[model samples]
Target: MTRITDTRDGPAEGARPGALPVAGLLLAAGGGRRLGGRPKALLGHLGRPLVEFAAGVLRDGGCVPRYVVLGARAADVRNRAELPGCVLVDNPGWADGMGSSLRAGLAALAATDAPAVLVTLVDQPRVGAAAVARLLAAHRAGAGLAAAAYGGERGHPVLFAREHWEGVALSAVGDRGARAYLRAHAGAVALVECGDVAAPDDVDTPEDLRLLD
Candidate 1:
């Protein structure tokens, strides 16, 4: 069973008055098999674990009661990462892939009052607070599904309204993680251009670690 540790209650304190309460869900459970068994969440960046930086991006982007899904070395991440005010979700099936972490995150957030959730990858360090704010703005502007776009192509930090949660969770299998759902409803997704303010390059291989530099 997944253990969802709720660190806070009530509507999102980070959201502005009369604004839609949106929760930020960070998927940081990858066991970097391509990086010699190291967990991505525990990867060092900016003098702290990568998970810490990613979680901070969510908080700074104005998301309250944030949720982080941990799987690979869950205990180690909890011990090493300083994620105050964020709900830590344990996803035992994380080895299964991103979908498991997504499902775990959505399940934990199901108990919240947030009308939407902004899903971000822990590996995407370059997708900063600006990109997140853009997606949140799209949601506030009446878009049900919104995603960051770079050079006209859609990318991460996707915002999903409550109505799409069930479908996304159902289609979420393996590493797909809403990819299929987003594709199925492409016409409705609001693509917010974030190329100027941020980048979407993800940290994966040894060569990609340079992105963190």
Candidate 2:
């Protein structure tokens, strides 16, 4: 899971008010042990790297200045991933788990004037710009936490409210990311039904990629 929140009121000066302060946090730190140590983001999908597709979705959704958190094989992924305006962040503690990457991404977002963030994974090719926009709109419409749900299962690219930024930051430190944190604050979360079967599909192994093909 990835933790992204709104921080439009951050210390950063010159941030636009009511502009839906949002950032795109792309988590590219997975080791991909399931794929025999391959960098999943670098994997090809229809002639484009997985990371590119994910970034394109965020970009199309109007997510400004996306930030990608890298871990193992960071250099290779960075060089191969073709995200024109994305900012890369190296997460040295990514070995700990997805939580570490989330924290690192959040730390970088905190510096920006963005009040909300849309966090997604590089391996989830099924999640598109429409899904991201839906979640963002829901969050801005007063939901503290807005996430896409497929077949009743809550999935990635969750949009978090700025009020919960600190909790998300603290939760994303160990092996777990924001699962427990979101669960504990269930009252603040609103689930948006994606209905699309592709929304929950993620490429974690060669077979998963083949399925997409």
Candidate 3:
């Protein structure tokens, strides 16, 4: 792993000025099977691509060196979305499930100077920057593994300290996407309630498109 120089400005909470930056890993390679084979990353939200909004949330939350996994019409997403300053990773096996994208993101982060990673999904348009910030705050306060929760239920935008990246990558397979790892380490995960700040709505089938409205 190459020790990339940390150039992130305005270090986020828990990310000390001299310490490594926290990576924002966006898994946006879903093929949107239920949405008539449309790619979730290209779904429109707030007059822009869904990936744009999702990536913005991570950026605004203070995550540095954002990485977005692309699959299923990856070219279309790259051309249509204005994701400046974000590293795009291609996951050839994206159709296999979210786990592949998560693994790819982790692999990319492993080569960087990020100490932890905040993982978000492109289909989740409602989970915003506040929820991401809360998770980072939890990490800064000594929580090694933290996740955004809604009504006491674990949800997206999970934060994984560098120490757990390898484990998460290993467990990430198919669509489980860290479910096994998180479940095994449930006792250590800090569930930060974010229901008030954001909704865990997912834009999957046509019915789910209403969420973007």
Q: What lDDT tens digits, residue by residue, belong to model 3 across residues 1-213?
A: 111222234534335657776789999999989999999999888999999999899989989878889999987888899887788888888899999889888987887878899999999888999999999899989988999999999999899999999999999989999999999999999999999999998888999999994
Distance from true location, Cα of 182 in model 2, Å: 0.8
RMSD of each: 1.6, 5.0, 3.7
lDDT of 2 by residue, 85-144 (tens): 677788887788999888888888787777788888888887888888888788778787
Candidate 2 ranges with C-alpha deviation above 4 Å = 1-20
TM-score to native of every candidate shown? 0.95, 0.87, 0.92
- In the range 79-156, model 1's lDDT, one tens digit per residue, is 888988889999999999999999999988888788999999999889889898888889889999999999999999
TM-score of 3: 0.92
Comparison by lDDT, 1 against 3, better one: 1
Taken over the whole model, the C-alpha lDDT of each candidate is: 0.90, 0.77, 0.87
TM-score of 1: 0.95
Model 1, runs deviating above 4 Å: 9-20
Backbone clash total for model 3 is 0
What's each prediction's clash count?
Answer: 0, 7, 0
On lDDT, who's better, 2 or 3? 3
